[model samples]
Target: MARDRRPPGRRGLPGLGKLFDMVDFMYLSGWQKFFERRLQRYGSTVFTTPLFTKTVVATDHKAISALFDTIPFIQDYGFGSAVPPKPLVGDVAPSVFETGVLHDNPKAFYFSLLRHRATSLPAVFEEVLREYEVRWASRGRFAWRDEIETFTMDFVLRWILELKFDTAKVRLIYNNIFTNHLWRVARFFPWTRYSRSLRYYGEFVRAIEEASSFEAIMEIARTFGISDRAYVAKQIAFLTGMNSYLGLQNLFKSIVGELSSRADIRSDLDLQLRDAAPGALFSPRVRAVDEFVMEVLRQHPPVFFIFGRAIEDVVLESASGSFDIAKGERLMGVIPFAHDDPEAFPDPASFQPERFQDDEARAKLIWPRGIQERPADTADRTCPGKDVALLLAHAFCTALVTRYQWTVVKPITWDKHRYSLNVAAPMGELEVAGFTIRDERAGRPV
Candidate 1:
């Protein structure tokens, strides 16, 4: 097929409208309507101005999938620091990009490590129980949002770091990295939280500097062909700073929001989990928990769209038509759009875990890089922690409902007509506020 030789016309408004769209996008609110309106007016695939730049946004799954799978796209970090500064006190070796040939590629390293660790989820469930036991015992009243955030950080640290260092300090450093740092310079300010984070950051690096302290993780790294102790230490620090803490925290909160509104689904989930044995909760054969998790994810995928820059000239074909994509153009695979496509998802607005019971239906869902069923190891861009994140959510949910009873202090109402910017769910409601829990065993109602 011949390419569309003509230059594409402008999409939506010019000048300030592009800046406005960028602001709405950054806030994760108000931008969906803007995107939807443009897609309706133009086509499934159109070049729209976002962030003061012309970006091709594809709503059709075929176009998005091709953008992800067949066409090559380079990661664009935008203006933010590529990564929060590597521990300032380390050996100061250049990153893999500078080192050129990496024996143990970091991407492959994490993929292999997560895959191997996923097998031990049963033990991870026990850890979840212990963490909750500590929280439930001393608490009289607590905010659901705050508790979930704390729990998420604690869980991720223990699971990934194995608690070899001070958990509190590490959490602080990571929090500062995300919230306080600008151009990665906050560490230089005295008396501020960011400077304090810098101090702990060095201590945290020194602790993991040996790398051999983590025997199991080191073994996997070795198998992947990386044996440098300092290199492993640097990777550990990078992993620690990751904001998966924010991702899982938001995810669980959304789950609670859904549970608050739907008494029927919540009741069923509670009943299924309450009677199941500890081992049963981690069983691959268990469908109830899996179904619930899948549905929530399908409804509220954490990533709205996978963004990348095209590396070559390409033609993207969708239900609407084939469109020419020039080399060096920025492309966004709109995950929410694909998830909501009516042709693929009948009654796409409704929350129904039953849809995922069919393998075919499950295959249609996309989170970031690819469909849920594909192995993360197979793709360079696939989230290595996808399986682990899901497993952690499952274990935590199991612990949350079975061990205690909770009340939604504020009634939850769903607006079926609206949509979420963070989550693609139709309700447009993603917050979990005013929820409280009580210890059922002690007969205490707080």
Candidate 2:
């Protein structure tokens, strides 16, 4: 075979580097560091390597921003392959041919519903916060990640379902599907495919399908003229639940942790919320709080990478050079690297919320779908619920600061330079002992 002409990268284990990429994509904790280090070492922002398939990892901020909207680079959900291939539970894959749709209608309906319901989120969040507040205040210190995870799960379920369901049972279902050890282990050992957690995932999917019978969901199905109401419901639930649940947990944890450590930022935040009336408490007229949320997302994006497939042979032109990618090839835009690119973000390493106070600088902050200024759309596969996510985060920050003042039980430190790609480590770094909270208004222990 003629030597494969491609931009060079770490050719992991063997067999076109499939095994290496699999481990790096899944089991490897800080897998993104490998991409970053390789990009830095090879002196190229765009380099080809074997990831789920032959992949071109693009780290240049401008290149990535343009590629997200480019026609050739389309969204790929990794169907009929390893690594969470079956995102839904059904014989009919949720694609154009199978579902007679391409997620546009369903996503549009869901996004509209979520946006319409956005006004109600403040009340919902306050209710959920109160429930946690009682428990957290009584104990004084709780496992930060565990508590926040539960809090987010409750909020997501209630907001999406809007039905009276057992919160604890629903939490169990989500936990088993997402974080259960045995279910994860079963993936490696084929014989253990019958794991109970795996069964629960199936059951959870079915439950979402059954939930279509609810009046709230029926209204969505009726409005969209969707014949397969069950399928639409399942897709909406999966999109809204998993992505928002996981993303919000990280966002919430990071916001709380940041405020705890940075006294100056916290003090500034306190002054901003000082004069808010009850009606304005949830949606405070505050710039610092909103700016702080944007900075957190830029510095520590909840989803590190946005992946897609190349639908046609195309050349990605970056300042580095034009890199060729073949049809059917996989690609990932490293958001962490793009957000930290010096050309885009000055003093990228420092935490500065003020950077976003400017409209031009704020527009540069890109999440998975598109730039901050642009609304998400189905064509680009940008999450439609992007605004809703920001709304909830902003409201949650207001509720948290106004409700209580918190102190870390043990010092929590995050070294982004060393472990930016380690998604699972930050939450654990938040220790349970010695953390305390006090009523901000009353100035007494909660």
Candidate 3:
């Protein structure tokens, strides 16, 4: 099959009628490979008609950096439009994706919620781990992924807003509203499904409002001398639950699956956890967890691509060559490609935690750029929950390694077909066998 080498402008592109076959093919199959191959073939710059959307995908670091730096040349393509009509995050999804403006103040307000004082995620994390230890005490060997999700969901609801419900019931409701029938319906009839999702969204918003007294949360904010509960809620919805849930769930599953398979990595992680003083499950050794988690993220980023629409026509210079991108053109910073670039990260494919061991290597690892660079959580940047997500990933992994002894019950593999947009666990019985480590000092499992 000859490739459609249309010129840069949209006018020369194939019509929907002529493009439907390609669209359907890409939408349903080989999308990740399609993007990966395109990145390889075009040397970090290529155009695709995936989902009938005209998109410019850039795998070049210079291009990605330029896209991040040039404000006028990049715009947020909010979550509502990206994954529209899906329950849990329909058109009303709260994100910079919904609001075009950077909204830095709002982003900061939301970031604060994930921090310790206000929403108490750290405390919640500790409590959940303690509860999980007790729950798995006598089981000896257990499926760790399910337990982790249950714990994470419970913590997110309890500390974030004090939402109360039966754990199983809440999980079932959330799965239905976010993952099960809603996802299937949205796939088949997007418009109707999305509209229905909005109804669920309304219920969720109401529930959140009910769970957390808006006036009281706001008063707490004011007591801290900070106002704006609405903004806080939006931020919380986006960061604390919506964004965090997808990534954390995937991260928990992926990390466990990988640890179960790779004994060396697992042993190293376990040793690090054990070295920590007893009852220090949530302490500084968590940094080791962060490093190991980063390695996993590099291998399998939950969101493989970060995108920004060009705000104005611009030229991005790269080691390979210069490319002219027009205003309104969409640029997808292909994260997997960048992460695998050997120049930035030598031997990118090998699961070597030591790759990030050196301070210099750590500095170059741009998963979350520092303040001098564009903060990964900048309101303008697409991955706003980067810090929060990393923290959660670190905490979750450390808790698992420290509190339990585990082994893979099945081989872990990434399912490219599961979600066209994000990396997900391969469908099947994805299980891990683990036992809570008994700590005699505490007279219970830790």
Candidate 4:
């Protein structure tokens, strides 16, 4: 492949180029909409742009998998060079995908660690969720999105770091840290809340030290050679932020807000839950909840796009042909478009949970990124928590679908517009008017 032979992409003003997105396209539709429209016109699997940096966006699965398969990925997801690679990421284990400290075989190290922990996740998650319900059980209605966000922060902090802070305090701190997104806060100095994010993270570390003998990062430190406890904690905390505002909340809103709106779908969910063993509400035998979670991930995954840069020169192939992306050029996977592609999904944007029931459709749907049999290498930039994420989603929705009747007070859109850039919260504050808890023991709606 020759250099500069790339797929067609939208052109923007010279020097400025698609950087105009911050000002021009933001108000018109959204960041995701701009790419969706362009991909529709271009009809290419991969394309290059001058957005933020020289960007090549791909919507094809093979192209995305090829990008992750390449080793030593440096410029990934966030803007490289413009922002610090990591600030205050202290001493500890490196991430499997984006290495905190690069190594030749860190991928296997993380894969082993993550895989080992998967089994215990089910029991651990159920305990944390029970705590969540006990803490925030209320009458009348409340914004389920905000409630879930608070619950998620607590769940992650307690389960992973064993950092037990007041849930209200955690929400207050996290909200302010991302109050203005990174661009507004991180770019400016004294005005920046970036340091505050670090401070709160450090607080979690302190709390963990005070709270217990077991720290999640300590597992990595003891396993790996690094004694940099602070760094390992920071890295784990950062990645788990996927649940903080990005992955989990987006999923909750889509299911409770959108999917539940269809009376038939809600009935199916109730029937399936009723048939399951009451003792194990979301056991593997209760497969509808599993299918429902997969559909939610397929439609409104936490990330709208996946970004990475070439460590060195690399070739990316598509059904049409092959193109070479030079070292340092950025690449993005436009997940939303690919998830909703009409040909790929029979009724693409229709919120059909039944589509996921077929293994063939599930195989083609690429939003969850990579969670098939071959196993995830730390080298893979795919979401490290993919399996646990699915499990947690199932557990959460099982609780809600089985025990409560939720109604969406306000309409929600899958196009993520509300949360700060750090989070890919797919919907805004989902005002759920009536969330009445019903007795599941009776096997009938209250």
Worst 10 residues of 3 by lDDT: 1-10
Model 2 poorest 10 in a row by lDDT: 91-100
Model 2 agreement with the true structure over 266-340: per-residue lDDT tens digits: 767766776554324555458888899999888777767777677787776665866677778777788878888
Q: Write down the TM-score of every candidate.
A: 0.79, 0.84, 0.78, 0.81
What lDDT is reached at residue 211 by model 1? Answer: 41
Query: How many clashes in each candidate?
Result: 0, 2, 3, 4
Best by TM-score: 2
C-alpha lDDT score of every prediction, in listed order = 0.62, 0.66, 0.58, 0.60
Per-residue lDDT for 1-446 in model 3, tens only?
A: 13323223222245663265355345654556766655565554544444335666666555566655667555556554345334454334555555533455555555555453444667767777677777766675566656666776777677767675344544433434433435655556645644444554556556666664456566545544456544555445545445556566776777777776677877687676666654464457555676787788777767666667776666655545666666777776666666777777788878887776666556544453221123556355545557666777777676666556655566777776445422544444555555657552443455
Residue-level lDDT tens digits of model 1 in 127-241 = 7656665665566555666566566666665566555466567667664453453525654677767777778877876677644437777887887678977677666675654
lDDT tens digits by residue: candidate 4, 36-104: 676677777677667665678777666765544566335344323333324433333335334444532
* Residue 97 miss distance in model 3 (angstroms): 1.8
Q: What's the TM for model 4?
A: 0.81
Q: Which portions of model 1 show Cα errors greater than 4 Å? A: 4-20, 27-29, 40-45, 50-53, 71-104, 115-120, 164-188, 210-212, 273-279, 411-446
Which candidate has the top score in lDDT?
A: 2
The TM-score between candidate 3 and the true structure equals: 0.78
Go through the candidates in order and give the C-alpha RMSD of each one to the true structure: 5.0, 4.4, 5.5, 4.1
lDDT of 4: 0.60
lDDT of 1: 0.62
**Per-residue lDDT value at 55 in model 2:** 70
What would you estimate as the lDDT of candidate 3? 0.58
Preferred candidate (TM-score higher): 1 or 2: 2
Q: Give the lDDT of residue 92 in candidate 1.
A: 42
